[model samples]
Target chain A: MGGKVTCTLGEVKNRADFIVYWGGNPAECHPRHFTKYTLMQKSPFLPRGRKDRTMVLVDIRETKSAKASNIFLQVRPGKDFELITLLRAMIKDQPISEAQVAETGLTIEQLQDFVSRMKAAKYGVFFFGMGLSMTRGKHMNSAALLTLAAEMNAFTKFVAMPMRGHGNVTGADVIMRWQTGYPFGISFNRGYPRYNPGEFSTVDVLVRGDTDCAFIIGADPGATMPQPAIDHLAKVPTIVLDPHVTHTSKLARVHITTAPAGISAPGTAYRMDEIPLPLRPALKSPYPSDEEVVRRIKEALLEKPDWMGERPQMLQNQI
Target chain B: MDLKVIDHATCTFCGCVCDDIQLHADDERIHQAKKACVLGKAWFLNHTAERKYPDALIDGKEATVDEAIAAAAEHLYQADMPLVYGMSNTTCEAQRECVEMADHLGGLLDSHTSL
Candidate 1:
């Protein structure tokens, strides 16, 4: 799920006979997942469109998204590992103990039927999210699902993806990986790149009163971050470059409003599946682009004594 | 009002970034959004909202774009330990620029990466 989505969503729409949603609700998080592309839309290959594909929703409890599923398995929370592990064994035709099926709240026959359907399907896509990432045995749960997908690949085309929470979080992480060779929470303060979460993460830095001022480019931590970070942001001198008038904007010491990236200023964004798509602006914006604003800030910083007066700070700091 | 369809416009409102949105608009402003969900529609329709200032604001008062940039730059110059953040919604190109600025100023840069 990190970077290997072997099949595109378009392929999933046309070729995938079966789709599984585990621990995430696309109906709630990704509204267009069912409507625009996958289940609801009709294709030459899928003449039945929504009807042509089988949808399975596996969640801890009943969710609105379950309303769209052909099968909704209400798995007991914290037992995802046991359930998926058993499913893996079922794929290999290995017998599963009834006790395990009871823990999963599903009968052995139901599990057998699911395995048979997956084996018969032309293709399958298993999408999971926070439910798997945030649960006990976190990465292990996801790995179990991935192992299932890989094992299923032997019988039918199968792929897995994480329904990311933020729009460009995957993009951000991708960009960070390209630039710093690390995904997130990287610090270059020591004249070299350092990767640590609580120490280098934004809110943690603010909560520790480590930041004297803030140079916020496109995000609003005030609306989302913990109260302590927001309070720190409100009191500190801050520069904001955003499209809307966000919670952080109201308290911004320097609020430089810009056009929204995709709506007003066109750019590139990676989808949840790590598919890069071009964002075409529909209207002309009155304000500058985020890139332009950041470039100007970079230019402005270049003129500062802290910058112009010395070498790149990393080197200057080392001396 | 003349209404026209802008096809294949990607929604900037969310992470989904649905690119199939068709913003129906006129010579002056946007009117209706076809293929956009409720959140995307709300985002596209906001193109018509009236604001006292169209370009920028400095400490809540309207300011020219140059003034805002200068004010922000001046603030960065004064702070001994500035923190650069919130690039989750911006483009990769813009994010790199923010990183450049953060590194140049010897500031503490942070974002959704922490959370």
Candidate 2:
């Protein structure tokens, strides 16, 4: 199995001579990615900044980010997995025909050239976005890309990192890993943390009607989740905490307006590269912070009966 | 009117979480967001200190924060399987509270990463 091999944004700024944006349009989504960290930053290693670096963009369509790249490869929609697999095989000196390459909307010459560039670069990095991870193949596509990045290490220094979406998500992942020993998709019904993605994931649980109630904070899933999941949230008694009146708040049984994080709420938020930064709030809102509301909810729950029966505080062994 | 300048204010609109933004704000609203991108500018300019919406709402009707909290707890406690979800737009402190809430309720805990 291929595990994640990545470095901090500072490493990318200093050492990455070759950078690839796969399926992500960082120019618009993460505006400072190029100017502050990747292509435009002048470092000790990359003295010329954007002049010394090479950028490659691979996406189904031509986004604004393509303009910033030296080479833009327009891939066929839903063919990310196939393209990644071909790259992996090519990197290993395996055989692949032109017909197979054409199926992914890229010619054999383009892939061959891409492979040569991959092997020739001193330091390379891939920044994949939701366009790759949330596509038809989903995790399979992500895994393939990670595998390709790992394989490239044979010839040069290479790494891959996901361009995580919106506000302190990386913090949640990092914190959850520390507290529950799992990143996400966790259940504590058996008195300990249990991890399972498809089963315990919020969308799956809501779509299946397995959850009778939902406590939503920060995210507006009513506008983002699938119709069935949204319907289930409406069916159940849902509670929402957000600074503004969002789509989720409209359908929620209870909506508590809270101060927006990093704006009016003081706390920590992790960058996509897993760097923790302290939030310096500039304004004060009349509403409570999400932290206070969640803490109050927890205290309210504690006032009631104990849900865990005879289970010990610490689990001797995880089943 | 004098505006307060805050340097190194972080923008959490996206994953990059650019922390070098300089914000100029009064007590009511942010006047200018220097070194911020278009998205970051919109993010800072949109939210204000002035009261815009109700503090709490139960079934679309205005309610007290205490009443809303009690109602929320009652609903979650009464359910057989409750879900604590969506930590994407909040702080780490709130996220920790969410995890604790799930553990205490014996419920499902998830974040935007699972989606």
Candidate 3:
């Protein structure tokens, strides 16, 4: 009752009749999302393509993607959780006052119509974005959306997926889950992987100044992270591996130029739907690939004495 | 006007990772990226094979990749709590290496997803 119910983009393209874009603007942030993967593609189930599908966009403000949606619901800023909760209750046929729904800036009638459409659709999908996951209530907002998608399955096929941005972040998540049995925010202090979000998350770790040294690759945290976190990275001995001299590279103690992924580095990258794709490089680069540099760093570390002198190689259970 | 064309080239600017892009490139840079959106085109055309920066830099001074690698390893090895962060733009193979480095260093590992 409380797990993620989702499918690959192909399934979404072929089967989804009701598409709800929550807190995401595909038009600008992800330009090819609508045309390539979701709304425009014609499948046997949805032969008419755009005509056969219903796209509802829910966000705090109107964006270019709204032009493609059949309906645009602008929820009050920071009220996504309230609106989602109200919908959850309404879907269960529970009595809810219009005043409560009004606080979310959407009329009860609109929500009722939305619920009916969700129930009637052959396949429904909720593509939530950073606007939901990184906003007020954070993970709770995402969990609510996922829960709603899971509950909708009682009446029809429904699923939810995060509109993951940045190159190969989903790849990193999938790989971390495979290697450490955790997605992100991992700590290896005990000779085993431990998962903790607030405690081990990069921002929190840097803000807290808990880490002594940092090894960065592919991302420029100096430009993105909070000021305190940025300050801490500058204070520490940071090593950066990137294609360009990025913001983080400027602050780092050491910067190694690595070939850019998907452009000049050949390897595997995962799409937002966790679909693995082969990266074909179009140009040759003077720098080494990230994989080669990281492997070299790992090998350099291995040549030194083991920090972990005597400990169990594996643990049956992690605390 | 002769340019090398790569079909089925994937655009990694965003999560969609559209793999049907056709990239027309020369020895230095990509001249055209067909079937790519505005963002994808910028992503593909912005980077080049040219060595825009030094091969490696230490304390803001130019250095060899080997020296930088050794410096990075020494710094990470000497720390009590080293951190391995940022895998959003790299390949999965490199990500695996980062994770392995964290495990070996008994450090914290995180990604842009955490932000």
All models: lDDT? Answer: 0.77, 0.91, 0.92
lDDT of 1 at B76: 85
Task: State the fnat of candidate 3 relative to the true structure.
Answer: 0.92
Residue-wise C-alpha lDDT for candidate 2, range B8-95, written one tens digit per residue = 9999999999999999998988989999999999999998998899999999999999999999999999998999999999999888
lDDT of 1 at A140: 80
lDDT for position A299 in model 3: 94
Cα lDDT tens digits for candidate 3, B14-59: 9999999999999999999999999999999899888899999999
- The residue-by-residue lDDT of candidate 2 on A64-158, one tens digit each, is 99999999999999999999999999999999988889999998888999999999999999999999999989999998998888889989999
Task: Give per-model TM-scores.
Answer: 0.83, 0.97, 0.97
Q: What DockQ, between 0 and 1, does each candidate earn?
A: 0.56, 0.77, 0.78
* Model 3: residues with Cα > 4 Å off, grouped in runs: A1-3, A314-319
**Model 1 chain B: lowest-lDDT 10 consecutive positions:** B46-55
The 10-residue segment with the lowest total lDDT in model 2 chain A: A310-319
- In model 3, what are the clashing residue pairs, if there are any? none
Docking class of 1: medium
Interface RMSD of 1: 2.6
CA lDDT, candidate 1, residue B44 = 79
Residue pairs with backbone overlap in model 1:
A167-B15, A219-B86
lDDT of 3 by residue, A74-146 (tens): 9999999999999999889999987899899999889999999999999999999999999999999999999
